[model samples]
Target: MIHPRGIKSLFLLMLLFPGFASAQKDWQDFMKQFPDHLDISLLIQDETGEPLFQQHAGKRIPSASIIKIPILISLMEKVDEEHMHLDSLYTLQASDKVGGAGELQHLPEGSRITFRYLAEEMIRISDNTATNILIRTIEMDYIQHWLREYGYEDTQLNRIMMDFKAIEEGRQNYTSPQEINDILIKLWNGAWLNENSRAEIMHWLKGCADNSTIPSQLPAGTVVAHKTGTLDYVRGDAGIILGDKPLILSVFVEKFDSMEEAESAIGQIALKAFRDFGR
Candidate 1:
């Protein structure tokens, strides 16, 4: 007679493999649903290192502000190293002020904000001013080393937060869907950050000020830890969709005719992913 533990193990394996198979098939079907003209790249992978869907997962794209992931990671590492404190104050300067999507810019110069508060603004509201301040305080080489150590060669922050010179030189910033997905997965697993740091990051991401992409199509109660990046006609969202089985996803669309069109396309893709594999 087979052992009781063996029987249980067999049953568990049977239950898990079917869901994996179904997720893969659903992703394949969804890829064929979209038109060929759209310049898009996407990746959906479950927590078990299984890819549910993939399309141009390796292609490089202008990350816009999505490059902030590295900046955020660098900050956390600093906290871990005892070089900084979450509650430590960072005084905003004129150089830190940059034009972008956020409320920090509206605040007058010399506004004092805690590092934790700045991190919240950076992720929650995609605040460029807060991002710049953090970047300025945290060394770029440190951020670059963090990315390389994490095996994210394709994700690079070539310039400080919203540096116009870099933007003008065609080196604004860049990352891949695969890279973003990897970052989100690491963050979700608390591997890239200490326990407290991971919790704080997720809390901020959950309240992301912009959710027009991934969260826009999911159910009301679906928990998504995500970040959205936008500039003119470009739009991108990357995050982990937490449900019964969490799936890491990154969808980037650029060169669209208009922001509205880009958002609609992203919504369609997200809806399909949710309906097909989010079960």
Candidate 2:
């Protein structure tokens, strides 16, 4: 005979997953309304681990700067281990500069910035230069270690952003919709941090100003802590929706005619999930 708790849990899973197809008809219907021009993948889950809804979740695609989420988590681990400090200052050099999404590239060489500034700018503005600073400080392999430990087998950060040489060498960053959502779940579950540091991570995510995707179509007052990634033909966002029945949403769009179309699709998907999940 099944244990009482196990039976109850099994019942909950049945209730959520078995009926998900029928219950998420609107989401399916919404997708039908869009043109057949994009590879759209979505995954949403309630506070529990139930698969609220998923489509093409296991498919891997370019992550753009969204890979920074894992990078951030790895950095936090180092912070907790006392190997890094929020107040520690990192000096900027000419080599650290990159050309996408940040004020750091324009800042003069010989500038000094702290971990707090770099991390915040990295998330808030999707700052590529700040990401390089973090990548150089902690190393790309260090972040990959965290991804493996966290069970994200298909997610990879093989090269830094806008790296043409790396691209020429066949290096790229990739992640699945399911894996991205899983990372958010780990963060939500407080996988490896104490209260203060976890809260700080959330704070930085909440500070993100590029709300072009998941948070775009949510209710005006809705609070979402998410990271967005954009490339010429790809757009992605992943994070949590907080306050009253929190939900996690990750949407990835690739091979689109225009960035605007992809961003609109993600916003619509996020709105559907927010409504379907009863948030």
Candidate 3:
């Protein structure tokens, strides 16, 4: 039996020691269970954008489709600047189609697609053809400028998806878990876009088709506005967890034996974060 004053002291002691110790153990042990070749970058920031837990968060890795997040941001910024309108239509020719994740290639040639519709498919389904269409429609310099201005110095899109020539040239898109989370935090805080644009972007993100990663282990009906980028065995999922406490998480898994395993690992990480942060 302990006195009430002693109970209060015990609680403080737990907070000062066991809390940090447990979190550290959880992260380290989880990572150690997997081989080191599996390059994984994870970051969890509280609603205030303060770091709660980070592992290899700064390491630059393959951006995969996650690079589209910044691309989408720049597109939205262009819209806000009145340089482009979401409703503006662009004709997609046979030459514009790329082989990869999206369904756009199956569409009829000369299919007119609105910028907003392209952006929607770009995010919601990780559509490669739609992404390439936007990349072709939006200037490369414009996207790079926006990323630099946004402080995503390490994140850039160097080529359209499935650009084998660019691949031969060793030019590829790249981004990190840290950068994506920063952008997500900004989007969550409404830092960059106007109300209407932000609202629409969030709607598209929530409609994202991939749920095997961060959102998989979360409770059903949990609203996570996230996008998933996968390149072979590497996977990235960055999003805002819109639950009781509102958290931000970015998990990048690379060089895994299989995407299935990588996604399972990420789902576990997200579950731990949910347990820690969700009220």
Model 2: colliding residue pairs: none
Residues 92-192, candidate 1, lDDT per residue (tens digit)?
Answer: 77767788678888888888889999998899888888887887788777788888887787898888666778888877678898778878877777775
Candidate 2, poorest ten consecutive residues by summed lDDT: 1-10
Better of 1 and 3 by lDDT: 3
Q: RMSD (Cα, Å) of candidate 1?
A: 6.5
Scanning candidate 1 in windows of ten residues, the lowest lDDT window is: 1-10
Residue 89, model 1: lDDT of 84
Tell me how far the alpha carbon of residue 23 in candidate 2 is from the true structure, in angstroms, after superposition: 1.0
Off by over 4 Å in 1: 1-29, 32-35
As for lDDT, the candidate ahead, 1 or 2, is: 2
Q: What local distance difference test score does each model get?
A: 0.77, 0.83, 0.83
Q: Per-residue lDDT for 1-279 in model 2, tens only?
A: 222443355467667676744666756777888788788887777766566667787778888888988888888889999999989998899998989799999999999999989999999999999998898788888888878877787789999877989978988898887788878877888988877788999999998999888888988988998899887867899889884788888888887888888989988888877787745
TM-score of 3: 0.90
By TM-score, the candidates rank as: 2, 3, 1
lDDT of 3 by residue, 1-279 (tens): 222333354456457878865776677777788777887888887776666677877778788888888888888888998999999989889998888888999999989889999999999899999998888778888888888886786688899899889977989888776777878888878899998889989999999998999999888889998888888757889888888988899888888888888998888888878888766
